[model samples]
Target: MRKKIIEFKNFNFKYRVQAEPTLKDINLTIYEGEKVLIVGPSGSGKSTLAHCLNGLVPFYYRGDMSGELKINEQDIRTKNIFELSKIVGTVLQDPDSQFIGLTVGEDIAFKLENYCVEQKKMKEKVEKSARLVDIDEELQSSPYRLSGGQKQRVTLAGVTVDDVKVLLFDEPLASLDPATGKGAMELIDNIQKQDNKTVVIIEHRLEDVLHCDVDRIVVMDNGCIICDTTPDELLSSNKLGVVGVREPLYITALRYAGCDINPEMSPKSVKTLNIENCKSKVKEWFEITTISEKQKKCDTILELQDVSFSYSQEKQILKDVSFKINKGDMVSIVGRNGAGKSTVSKLICGFYKPTSGKILFDGKDIETESIKSRSEKIGFVMQNPNQMISKTKVFDEVAFGLKIRGVDENQITERVHNVLKTCGLYGHRNWPISALSFGQKKRVTIAAILVLNPEVIILDEPTAGQDFKHYTEIMEFLIDLNKKGVTVIMVTHDMHLMLEYTNNVIVLSNGEKIADDSATNILTNNEIIQKANLKETSLHELAKKCNIDNSIEFVNKFIDYDRRVR
Candidate 1:
């Protein structure tokens, strides 16, 4: 009989700094080889639960604890973090923060070195793990220089090299691109199946994992496990929506079409879900309408004319890349890791000088523009909020840019408050940055940029570690900003965000532009999808399969069904 790999019986915990428990009475048991996904909105105690399982709760974090917790059928109270590490391998959300070595190979070998493993055996394990995670080519490269997805893969290699029985991933897919995220999901499933290892994933992006052979769904809310069930049953249940977990987009599309359908149906078996009945429901929902008034008036705001960039004399990162973002346009730049999406943003903001060609903003050459002058025209929000934040308090963090530019103190206060309200950070204005959750920190970063009121805004992976609700709010806020003439360009790997928020899409592969066109057009094109290593949005595929040329309605139906199922 398989042993229970993890057990939480009437467990409750409160951080030393907090007045209340972060997790409460979380009763859960994960058996060997079970692939479970724990999900919730931001601050729902998902991270707290993960911490408990890996011994971070009582070991490193000073916290008030109640109830019992066991791993590998042994009480957690008896083991320190190092002993737990022998049983459970943990991969955190940010890969850079966990990296201990300069190169990928060295990073993967660090943990083994601490265990006193012989150098020969360590090298063999490192190579094997590197190949397993498909990062053999990156073994010699500096981890700091790799893209976010590559960094994440390297972190996985480091964790798995220990040959731990159970693996815990905290938002593993957050930093990965569509193709890489899918590959990571498949890899996790493969590991679980081949080794009979217990797999626990805390993630907000449910779409990919829902189809990846998950065993169970553990939904949390306000420090409690509100529901525990199989993925199909969870998706099919109405309580999930009440509890606020993100349902599958395909199911949502079906629901929006006025069809009473269950989201709990396995996505892999979508073909058998009476797909024909779903077609007309979707048609009625969308009504084949043209682009909204807000979607129109997207005139050319910035143009890259045969732009090429290189940091070294050896090779160009961006090769003659050219694209246009019209006024009131929300455009997404997407590609595999290290494909120059962020580099393009840097060049547009004058952080990096292009090797050849030109960038035109509002029909004026920006190559000669001073960094200070360019700062007034473009607001750049980096991927990591911690990097952007300088002040201790949220209000100060939001107002720092304006204060530096010599704005009046009173006006800065007013603008800061207004932007905070817009970004849903008003309630926490005076709170310290350390007190806020990751999603809240991201909002603070965006609010700081928005307060600057620049003509153009660029966000690098804005929704990377955010939950579904936060993701939607940020996208909607950006859409509103674009409607008011703030041209928004986002460097993203989020396919759903691109489909729902952006009007224009740019596809890149191996540092070269493969396609630039309307979001709908680019997403539907097989050539671009293949070249860019992108997965098709489920609703988009369903429409094509059912001969639904006008896709809006079909997608809407899915939206409706998805809501009902959730």
Candidate 2:
């Protein structure tokens, strides 16, 4: 018989600031050695549940709680935060925020030091934990200086150092690239096997998390658990999309291709899915699907000519990179972390002067232009919302740029409100910035930039931590902006976003521009995908499995239809 490790019986919770409850009448049971995924749209109380497990609800958050919650058969009310920490180890979405030690080894040992473990044992445990996460060589390096993937591994090492029986991961894949995310998931899976640990992951990236074997998937909405079922059952149902959760891309493509999936088919089967059973159906659908012709390219709006940049003489970040952005184009800048993707955005935005090269904005050299001058023409939204948000209130934050330019109150109000509505934050316009969730704060920052109405917008991982609903909302709004003649440049690691929304793709690898072409073309080129460390979309694989003629064309048509319907 499986051991029940965590249980919630009719639990309810409400934050001190809110009038209504954030969690309502929840009943759940998680068995030992099980991997469970909790998924929901933004503001769905997923993070709140994680906080409860980590003893952050009543202790840190100061919330009113009722009913019973237990871990290892002990009631949560009987245990203090310090005691709970030994039972449940939490790794936050932002590893940087959780990091305390200056160096990697120090951070991993920080937790052990608090418990006053012997000096020899502490060093042994730290090294062992670091090796488990594949960060042994980075022991002497600063935790803040490591790559996104490495930082996450460091956090994992710290959490596992104590050998806790239950582990909680909050959005572990939010900031990682597809390849790196897969690696993280594999590491977690291995840890669970070796330690028989009960793992709970709260994330919006369902497809990536599903790569590992998941015992159950819990779907939540509006502070309620709507469904709890296995991965096979959950994907077979239509509830995921109805509740604003994103289904896997291949599943979406299968539905788009008019293939009636067998009710009993498991999503696990889809990983090595054999399409021979439905080949004819898929082929017929492809034959009938209308392929939309590509849109005409507009005039070049910005150009980078032989751009070469280096932070130091020993390390070059960009090597003779060159590209052109057309007016009203929705282009994606994609690559692995530290592959110079964000650096390209920085160079274009005038954050750094190229070591040797010239950047042209509307046929004029921007090398001599100041950042303030560049800001007037181009708007940049960073990946982390906290870095971009300034004002205390959502409305004020969105209106900060307009007010700085001496805009009248009436005009500022009109613009701010419209942008808020477009960004889906109109209801929270008057709310305090601190009251909002991470995703909501992200929208607020984007709204602040959109109100400025710059000709070009550059966003670094705009949908990094966003759920499906917010991702669609933000992308659709950006698409509308592109239709209005604003050139949109997205620096992202999400291949789905690149394939579905953007028309042009710029592939960067080790400070070099390897390919600049259509999204379909870039995705279809194995050489470019490998060089840039990009994962091919499942749709591409689906087409090949079905043996469809001109698989690229079929995938392209499916994307077109998907966009039109959405």
Candidate 3:
């Protein structure tokens, strides 16, 4: 039998501020060198559980704890935060928040310096750790100067330098692009095997994380561990969908085609998935599934004529980028982190003036329009909710826009309440914004924008950290608003979001407009997907693996079927 590295026996913890326990009656054991994944929806106690493992619960969070918790067969409650750190190292969801030093070498060596290690030994350790994460070449470079993927590598190296026995990752792929996220998982697996360390990942992006291998998947819901099983077992059951976590797209596609999936068929990774037994069924279903032609809009509400942008004379963020968005149409802007996706949105919102080019709204040149004047016609929901949220309560934040416009008190109340209901935040209308989870705060921010009732809303990663249920809720709400003639432009890294909701997709690569076409066409094009750092849909791959012709049409029809079924 494998030795247990971490164990929790009837553990329960409650934060001082919370009325109820965050984790209740949990009994879990992780063996040495085992890789495990913990998943759940927002407010499902996953974060609290992770906090308990790293000693953030009793030391930092100030919570009431009961029952037994052990790390390496020692009661963790007897150890302080410093002692816990030596056993397990944590890599936060956002890499920037964890960074402290000026350069890559300093950040990784900061931990050793605190321990009063000799100068020569510290240098050797830092160099070794940097090389372990493949960041040795840029030791002198600033961590801030690196890309999102590189920033994560620096943080990973910083944590691994401590040589902790357990590595805990919190939403590791939260801020990464599709291809970059896949690479991060592979790197993590390689490190785990090379170091023989136990790994625990807390994430809601189940499909993306499953690109790696895990010994077991622990599913938490409503402050409890509802299921603890292998990935194949988890994917074969309906538990993931019922819990509002997304099953892999290919698994969902197999079920949609009426195939019986079993663990023996390797249902976890797409590359190893065995579908020979159900290939005929999938082919027949693809043959019968039909998709209707999409209706195109003629009127262009917004147009960019050869727009170019640069932060400085040295670096041009965007070059001669041009596209048109039709009125009442929903569109997606997609690319890697530095591919100028969010930069394009900022340019459209007039947050940053283009260095060169013409921007027209309804055939009117608004180059001279003030930011306040542009706000009246265009609404931009920033990526971080903390940037936009000003009031403590949800109602005030939602009504602030209308209140400042000289709207009557009665009208503001009615409008804000209606928007709150539409955003699934009606029950929390009076709750403090600080008490809400990240996903709830996201809905609150979107609710504030919807209350303004602008003709066009440009959102940056609207559903970046949201689970499947909230993602579906927000996307379906946007679809309703689109049908009611609200044009939505989203800058996102989620490929599934583009294919599922948006009719038109704009792909950016190296600060240039490389592809402007339908979502299916863009996703199915291997060359375009590679250029933009995007990943192809598993449904497209599934169709091709089953020998179905025209994989593009197969993906299009599947999206339609999914929308209708929902």
Clashes of each: 21, 0, 0
List ranges where model 2 is wrong by over 4 Å. none
Predictions in order: lDDT = 0.82, 0.89, 0.90
How far residue 558's Cα lies from its native spot in candidate 3, in Å, is: 0.4
Which lDDT tens digits does candidate 1 get at residues 1-566? Answer: 87888998999899988888898888999998899999898888998888887778899887899899989889999999999988888998878889999899999999899999999999999999999888999999999988767787888888889888889999988878887888888888887887777899998888877658778888988988888887667766665677666676666656555566654334433443456656676665556533333336546789999999887879779999988888877889998878889899999999899999999998889899977889898999998788888899999999989988999999999999988887777889999998787778889999999899889999999987787766767777786787788989999988877777776789889889998876666766778888887877777766765577866545544433433343
Ranking by TM-score: 2, 3, 1
Candidate number achieving the greatest TM-score relative to the actual structure: 2
Summarize candidate 2's per-residue lDDT along 1-566 as a digit string, tens digits. Answer: 98889999999999998899999999999999999999998878899999999999888999899999999989999999999999999998889999999999999999899999999999999999999989999999999988889999999999899988899999998888877888889999999999899999998889888888999999999999999998878887888998899998888878876776654556543565656667888888888989677777769999999999998999999999999999999999998888898888888888899999999998889898988999998999988899988789999999999999999999999999998988889999999999887778888989999999999999988897788888998899899899999999999988889989998899899999989998888888888878877777777778887887587898788889888888
Where does the lowest 10-residue lDDT sum fall in candidate 1? 557-566
Clashes of 2: 0
Model 3: runs farther than 4 Å from truth?
none
TM-score of each: 0.93, 0.98, 0.97
Higher TM-score: candidate 1 or 2? 2
